[model samples]
Target: MSTSNEPVSFPAGLEGVYVCNTTLSEVEGLEGRLIFNGFNAIDLAETRTFEEVWFVLREGRLPSQSELSTFVSQVEALSHLTLDEYKLVKKLRGGEPMSAFRSSLSAVANGRGFKSWMNRDKAVVAEEIMTLCALTPEIMEVLHTGRKPKLKAGNRGYADRYLWGILGKQPAEADLRALETYLILTVDHGLNASTFSSRVTVSTGADVGAALTAAVGTLSGPLHGGAPGPVLDMFDSIASVANVSNWVAEKMAAGHLFMGFGHRVYRTDDPRSLCLKRVAERQASPRIELAKAAEAEILAALAAKQQAKALAQNVPVRTLRVNVEFWTAVVLEHVGIPRTLFSSTFCASRMIGWGEHIREQIAGNKLYRPRSYYTGSKP
Candidate 1:
């Protein structure tokens, strides 16, 4: 190595950067493992309800039967949006679903008196969390259907309520289970872009609403939480298995991204993709079939053209595999969710993680401050 009088360079996009330490979750990209509060996320994805996982992430352990019953009751009690909140949601309808969700959630959280939760005890903060969890799906329901969410006074887990409340009908057993698995898988994943946004906002002593609002805005960007719907769009355009090769080739030649095929962190297959693929298979919807066929065709085409070095300098591109968004779109479509509500659906589940992370950040209590390299002229 040659020495030079120059500033040292860091990884772009903060890849492999450790911003802060936490007990929230760990993303082992190479190993394709995710651990949440010491529980294997894949195990929780298969065996636990969203409420159960929420309790684990927030309280550091899974809930007992009594604890789960009480927790479900509390979450249901907090799920209903007041009349004023509904009216506010109405005013914000007809915008992009994620955009509407962000504004409407901020309005609902502030209207419910956010200051009461700010700087309060964990229970109060948890109430604020439960409020967001309860309301996010409601907001998505109204935004998608232009109707008030159907509130039911009965025992239901958070994921089940979201499905039934949004559709205004009891979801099918298979559909409900599919959605439950989706919610559990997405509840948390290390410090993603949106979670970091929340942690940063909360670190500066902001309320949960402010922190979550920051998260929602960050999540709205296409680079972060906006790929699921487009994956469905890609499926629509491809339309059949026969067209997959030509479609992949044309898009690849034109330098267009295959919406659901890549991820930032996973060098190996995204384990969530594997979990969701099984759900998609069990659901057995036409869209899932199309997505699966397209995924296989794309992979085969990539492998065949590996010697050509089509997209990268490496002999093969590991990112040319299916990611969580591909199967997420398949499963969400299988469950009858509207495409427009995809990212909001993501937020509905991810809000649990956001709330838990904000609480953890506040408990640790340090402001985030990072230095930047300056390349412009300085006075």
Candidate 2:
């Protein structure tokens, strides 16, 4: 018997349900696993460039040297944003940086070539990836600097060249390598909240541009992609080596969740953090030591306070511990990008993954609507 007043129960955890068929990537959260189109991400991070990862995400296989060359050529060609689009990004300032970037993406999607490009079939996903790879940097530049960036001439591959063009000069090899690694690491992560939002938006038949815009909006939230930039800010606030432990304790007492400490999925340390930290170590910067000390104190305190709170220091702290952000900050700072631009740079990297996921969603064509057992209705 069912009645309006009957009580119901909604599932607290979606343990097993076929919510969607996402070939763009898979994440085994409990096991702390991440894979992009069947390749181990850690292995790929060590061996491949961001462009190569992008190819795997979109094409379901890696690019051969000849294929990579052609892909690089196409990506390099798409780096310039049209004049009208640039104007729109310049006008999107004065609010939150992520919001401004998201708005800028929405504006770009409404422009010519967006609609037709996004809805193409799987066979043309490669072309769509090329278009997106090109547009992302321009969008990021306008959002960060509030000005149109000049594109550099010559073929330097997409990640380095796009960042070089945005920064108005070529990056040093180390700087370019850091940016590439960050991009590859961020390219995909299982069914994170933001990625799920992207899948849901695309499932409704939204254009790929629209889906990506929605995903960016999700990523802008503090709980999602917005934490990394602030992790650096936390480091800056701590200031001196002596204040590290006290500062962490004060922040924790104030009920502020440490920006770079734990993750929802990874019970152990985040694999990506390990790789980024190693890169930062090899780079041999001063900030790495500061980050390492900060991380040590924070972890010790967390363990002392709650025995069960032992989520092995996640990527954010590991990243900060090794001063990954500091190294990146130095490079980007030298190139004239402001501190405010860090998150936008992050967005630029993640956009590749977002587009790939959207293409995968479109290919699988499953409505991502998940059912919840009614908790309010009478039964």
lDDT string, candidate 2, 1-379, tens digits = 3444455554455544456666777766555567889898878887898888888987889999999988777777776777887887788876787788788777776664555334556556545545765787777767666766765666456677657756767777776776677778778776776777877888887767677788888887766666656776777899878999789889778867776667656666667777777777776766677777887888777656554343454323322122234344433443345667666777787788877777667766767666544556445
Q: After TM-score superposition, what is the CA distance of residue 301 in candidate 2 from its true location, in Å? A: 1.0
Angstrom error of the Cα, residue 168, model 2: value is 2.7
Q: How accurate is candidate 2 locally (lDDT)?
A: 0.69
Clashes found in each candidate (C-alpha, N, C closer than 3 A): 0, 4
Q: Tell me the TM-score of model 1.
A: 0.92
Could you tell me every candidate's TM-score relative to the true structure?
Answer: 0.92, 0.84
Winning model by TM-score = 1
Estimate, for each residue in 169-278, the C-alpha lDDT of model 1 and write its tens digit: 88887899899999999889998999999999988877788899999999999898788899999998998888888898987678676788767778778899999999
- CA lDDT, every model vs. true structure: 0.82, 0.69
